[model samples]
Target: MIKIVLLGAGNVATHLYKGFKKANTVNVVQWYNRNLKSIETYKNEVKITDNVNNLIEADVYIIAVNDDAIPELSSTLPFENRLVVHTSGSARLYDIDQKLYRGVFYPLQTFSKAVDLDFTTVPICIETLRKKDFKLLETLGQSLGCVTYKVNPKQRPALHLAAVFVNNFTNQIYRIAHEITEKQGAEFDILKPLITETARKVQEVSPYIAQTGPAKRNDKKTIKRHLKLLDNPDQEAIYKLMTESIKKTHGH
Candidate 1:
């Protein structure tokens, strides 16, 4: 079995622990966090600890904490030359302490502690210093049923930036739409089908080809009406900016 020591109790850590536990080929031997209470509930299943000195002997140590804490926390690892990896999309692999082996095991998916994720659907991106260590991580990734990709440091940052545009920025637009609907006393639920269809269309066709609406059609009247409906200055600015961008992209 590929034994793992999971560090942190945040969303990514929680989901990873559950996913790995379900995979017969991998064993999560221990879970550690500075705040013991955050990981205490997992004690029934795996050995849990707060002190770094109490960490168990394991094949791999996976850090799933905040990005800023990675360098400092990694420096404190009492052991050396082990396969230590961090679960961050944007952090440089060099950020880990040079005294020990370091790598990245970034899952290209948004994690939520309350949400159950299908490991098979998540894209596991990995990079390691040694070729042998890469095989070890690849084996672990495949065991979890993920589609693994050997992504390097230089390319990883670009992927992370694109993810922010597609996932984070798009979600913010959804929030803006929800607020607009709610302000007019309309049920946001009514837009559910439209939202789903919009997503589905982009999956089957290029986003440019799937694009529609007043901005795409260069309907000035509708654009002016939308701007007028948006009472908030910030909302109006965003709407106007996006409308202009769409027009420029489509040559409207």
Candidate 2:
């Protein structure tokens, strides 16, 4: 069995704790957070501690804290030469103390504590400094029924940047749409179907092929009308920028 000590109490950590619990081959031996109350509720299920010196021996220590906290936390771990991995999409693998076996087990998906996520659907990007450690990390990821990929340092950052465009930036645009709909006294729920269809289309075809709308067709009149409808300068600026980008992509 892969015995893991999970450290952190945020969204990623919470989800991973649940996923590991459901995996028969994995045992979350301990969970730690600087703020003990954040993870005190799980004390009945597993050992919980706030002191780094109190960490027990485990096969792997998974650090799921904020990107900035990774280096300091890894450095403070009482044990070394053990497998230590972080669940950050953008943080460097070497962010962990060199005294330990450093690696990354980034889940390439946005996680929210309230949202129900299926582990099988989340892709795990694995990277290890030592060649021998790769298989162990891969097995850990597989234990949760996640599809694992060997992503290098160079590629992982690029993948994270692309993810920001697709997930974070896309969500912001959705918020903008919601605001626009609210201004017109229209039901924002009416756009739900379009959102679903748009997401479904990209799975079956390239985004380029799935492209449509006035901007893609270079319909200047419609673009101008949209800009005029957006009274807020920030909203108008975003609309114009996205329209120009779409037009450029389609060679308009």
Candidate 3:
């Protein structure tokens, strides 16, 4: 069995625990968090401790803490020459103490504690200190039904930045649309089909090719009307900025 120790109790850590529970070949030997109460719920299910010194000997130690905390935590670990990884898309693998094996096991998906996600569709990006160690991570990813890829640490940052534009920025735009609809006393559900279709279209075609809107068409009159409709200066500015971006992208 692949014995593993998981550190942290945030969304990524919680989801990893749940996913590991379903894999028969994997064993969660222990869970560690700075605050005992944070992961107390799993006490009955597995060994839990708040002290890093109490960590058990395991095949791998997965640190799923914030990016900034990764360096300090990894440096403070009492063990050495053990397989240690962080679940951060942008964090440099070299940031982990040179005394230990460093790697990244970034799951490319947004995680929410209250939401259930199917691991099969998630892409698991792996990077390891030793080339041979990648096989173990690949096995772990496959066990969770994820599509795994060996990503270079240098390339990982660009991938993370692209994700921000597609996921984070797009979600914020959706929130703005929802607010606008609510202000007009309209049901946000009315735009659900359009949103769904937009997402679907991008899967079948390039986003550039799938683009369709007044901005894409360079309909200045319609653009002016949209800007006039939004009363908030912030919203109006965003509308104008996006329209200009679309026009620039399409070479209009």
Candidate 4:
């Protein structure tokens, strides 16, 4: 079994730890973090340490810390005799120094502390320190049932940006719609079918082809009605911009 050390106790770490443990191919010999108390509960099951120097020898170190903390954390870890990886979609592997076996293992999905996640469906993007490390990563990815993609820093950043548009921005739109529904004294749950249908269409049709609404049809009447319905100027602006974008995409 490949020995591993996992850093951090946050969303990424928790999910990865669960999945890696389930795989049984990896032996999590040690887990390190800045705050000793953060992982106090798991101390008995897995050796947890606050001091970087006390880290147990492992074949690979998976750094799942916050984005800003990665470089500082990487600097402290003993990178020799081990492969080192971070799990951020936006951060490049080379952002950290090359003194050690450095790479990125970005999982392309938003993680929430409160929510349960299925790592099987999460797209795992792997970049590596060397050709030797590639096989190790691929093996780990398969254990989790992930759809793996080999991505470089530049391409990873682009995919991350697209994720923001599709996931983050889409969630924001949902929030706005929910608020509007509440204001109208209607259950926001009423829109669940429409939202599901939108997602379903995308799987079969290109997003450009699946798009519909006042914007896609160039229906001035519906556009004006929605704008009138929304009291918030920000919502109106978003609707207007999306409408224009859809029209431009569909060649309306």
Candidate 5:
């Protein structure tokens, strides 16, 4: 079994820990973090430590912490000639340097402590400097989920930016829509089926083809009406910007 030591225990860490446990092929030998509460269950399963020096000897060590802390944590690690990996979408894998086998195991999806991750649907973006390390990453990723891509830092950033638009911006739009619907005495739950259908259609059709709403049709009157209803300048500005972008892309 592949001996793995995990670092950090946030949303990503918790999901990965559960995934690793379910994997059964690899064994999580040890873990460490600043807070004990973050990884109490992980501690129960394997050796856990607050001090970095006591880091268990493992074939692989994954740092699933904040993007800013990666450089600091990687620099502080005393382990030599061990495979070190980070699970971050925006962080470049090389931030950890070439002195050790450093790689990225970025899972492209929103993670919440309460939500169960559908690993099979989550795209795993992976990269490594060494050929052997890349193969090792592929092996582990396949067991967790089949969709895996080997991408460079430049390409990874584009994917990350696209995700921010699809996930964050879209969710924000949903919130605004919910507020407007509530004020109109319409239950936001009525929109859930439409939301699900829209997501489902995207799987089969290109977003350009599945496009709907007044923005796609260049209905300026409807756009103005919606913006006036929004009232909030920030939301109106966002709505206008997104509408313009969509028209620029899909409009003739």
Candidate 6:
């Protein structure tokens, strides 16, 4: 069994804890957070502690806290030469104290504590300083039924930047759409099917091939009308920027 000690209480950490609990070959031996109350409820299931010195022996120690906190937490860990990994997409693998085995176990997906997550669907990006430790991390990821990939430092950061464009930036556009619909007294739910179809289409074909709308067709009249409909300068700017991007992409 791969015994893991997860240290963090955020969305990624919470979801990982729940996923690990369900994996038969994986055991979450302990959970650590600076704020004990954040993980107090899981004390009965596994050892929970706020003190770093109280950490028990485990096969892997996962630091899932904020990117800024990673270096300090890694430095403060009571032991060294143990396998230590962080669940950050952008943070450097070397962020962990060099005294311990440094590695990254980034999950390429947005996480929310309230949403149900299926581990099998999430891709685990693994990187390690020591070649010997790679297999152990791969096995750890596989334990949760996740598809594992050996992503290098450059590729990992590039993937993370692309993720921000796809997930975070796309979600912001959705929020903008919601606001526009609300101002027009239209039910935002009416656009849900279109949103679902857009997502589904990308899975089957390249986004370039899936492109549609006035911008893609180079309908200058419709584009002008959209810009005129927007009262907020920020909204107008975003609409213009997106339209220009789409036009440029389609070679308009």
| Per-prediction CA RMSD (Å) | 1.1, 0.8, 0.8, 1.3, 1.5, 0.8
Q: Model 6 clash pairs?
A: none
Per-residue alpha-carbon lDDT of candidate 6 for residues 40-98, written as tens digits (9 for 90 to 100): 98989989999999999999999999999999999999899999999999999999999
Q: In candidate 4, what residue range of length 10 has the lowest lDDT sum?
A: 74-83
TM-score of 3: 0.98
lDDT of 2 by residue, 202-242 (tens): 99999999999999999989888878788899988888888
Q: Could you tell me which 10 consecutive residues in candidate 5 have the lowest summed lDDT?
A: 37-46
Q: Model 5 segments beyond 4 Å from truth?
A: none
What does candidate 1's lDDT look like per residue over 1-252, in tens digits? 999999999999999998999999999999999999998887899998999999989999999999999999999999898889999999999999998899999999988888889999899999898999899999999998999999988888888998898899999999999999999899999999999999899889999999999999999999988888888999999998999999999997
- TM-score of predicted model 2? 0.98
lDDT of 4 by residue, 1-252 (tens): 888899998988888887887876878888888898878988888899998999888877889987888888888776464688888888878766567788888899988877888988799999886888888887778777898888876899899899999999999999999999999899999899999999889889887677767787889898888889989989888988888888888788
In order, candidate lDDTs are: 0.92, 0.94, 0.93, 0.85, 0.86, 0.94
lDDT of 4 at 159: 92
lDDT, candidate 6, at 13: 97
Q: Quick one: ranking by lDDT, best first?
A: 6, 2, 3, 1, 5, 4
Per-candidate TM equals 0.97, 0.98, 0.98, 0.95, 0.94, 0.98
Model 4, position 46: C-alpha lDDT score = 89
* Root-mean-square deviation of candidate 2: 0.8
Error of 4 at 90 (Å): 1.1
lDDT of candidate 3 over 121-221, digit per residue (tens):
89999999788679988998888999999999677888899999989999999999999999999999999999999988898999989988999999989
Model 6 per-residue lDDT at 21: 97
lDDT of 6 at 98: 95
lDDT-superior candidate, 1 or 6: 6
Model 4 misplaced regions, further than 4 Å: 79-81
Worst 10 residues of 1 by lDDT: 107-116
